[model samples]
Target: MSKISNFFKGGSSSSKSKHHRSRGTPSPQEAIHKLRETEEMLTKKQDYLEKRIEQELATAKKHGTKNKRAALAALKRKKRLEQQLTQIDGTLSTIEFQREALENSHTNTEVMKNMGYAAKAMKQVHENMDIDKIEDMMQDITEQQDVAQEISEAISRPFGETYDEDELMAELEELEQEALDEGMMSMGGLPSVPSGNLPSLRPGQRATTRRKVEEDDDMRMLASWGT
Candidate 1:
């Protein structure tokens, strides 16, 4: 019975010694590793929160919400989620803002492309400008003006008669010739020709011959000798 009690006591003390030995102090490296692991976990949570906040901001900007209040209100019960994310910012009311650039870089490119397309579409329209119709209208107006001129010319002249260009020129030439002939006739009287005959002498002629005998002695001697 004594041996059994001693054996039971030794067993208890050994178990207590084993427990004490198992509770040995941790190394500095182990404590540092645990601290780093906790820090990494916290860093991961911060990163997740930051990404979520950025996503929310992007959504708000895309919809063009009026104000933060409106955006917060739009979150509804999700506001709790946002609060959880922003709560760790520690006493600072300021928020981080990163501007998002416009995604549509080529603004005028669309307008220019459409303009080119419209120009190509209108090519046929520009080519078919109804030039023949315009020309026909112009010809009609010219013909009407010519008819009006003809009517005016007819009214200015004698009625029921029309003169052609050649006929008018001929008539003018004839009138001019007639005026020249009339002018010449008024300048000089008519011309006459002489007849081929001589007139006979009378008593005045015989007296003239007798006065010729008294005119010269040569003439009277020639007359008595009769040669």
Candidate 2:
């Protein structure tokens, strides 16, 4: 045992005795054997309990249970025990797995190395056995998993991809053309003039306001009258 401890801890020969000491935690091989034993024990207990329940039900039906409520209570108790037995069966299965690994490791040094890893895993399991911590971890994992799933789902969609430069430029041109067309239509095919209600001329053309044109007409009439 000291040798095994020293093997793992890199401890010195003098400290080997303390290092190799077992905490009575079952080795993988031992755990597997115990799992088998537990499996058989739970199976037997379950069968017995089932038989007892059946007997009680039959007797109650035949003799007419004085109190239906009492019979119901007994039924619930049996169900609770059955559930516990089911949990035990599951635990036994895990033990069996440990046992098989232990057996494999005994023949293969690699497997044995992994067995120490399994022991560490078991230690972590024990440490996190608290309901609240376990629940919190589970919730955190669930939330992260959900977020990842959502992102995956979104990215898989056709719309998830970004438009390339060429595509963006083409779209921009189309929008600009549409706006220009709308502006032309709104202007009744002519460009918008200033608020003075005068004809807006091109850069080389002369601009004439209605008031200025009317004043020119008045000056012409006065010249004709003088002539």
Best lDDT among the predictions, by candidate number: 2
Q: What is the C-alpha lDDT profile of model 2 across 1-227, one tens digit per residue?
A: 98897786765653666655744455656665676787688778778867866766665564446877767766666677667767767876776677677767766976777898999999998985888988999999999999999999988888655769998999999999999899899888875666787666764444455567889999999999999
- Writing each residue's lDDT as its tens digit, candidate 1 over 52-97 gives 7676666666555567675665454345556765664431222111
* Top candidate, metric TM-score: 2
Hey, what RMSD does candidate 1 come out at? 29.7
For candidate 2, the per-residue lDDT at 13 reads 57
lDDT score for residue 224 of model 1: 90
TM-score of each: 0.23, 0.31
Any runs in candidate 1 off by more than 4 Å, and if so which? 1-24, 65-70, 73-227
**Per-model C-alpha lDDT, please?**
0.67, 0.75
Count of backbone collisions within predicted model 1: 0
* Alpha-carbon runs more than 4 Å astray in model 2: 1-31, 63-66, 110-227
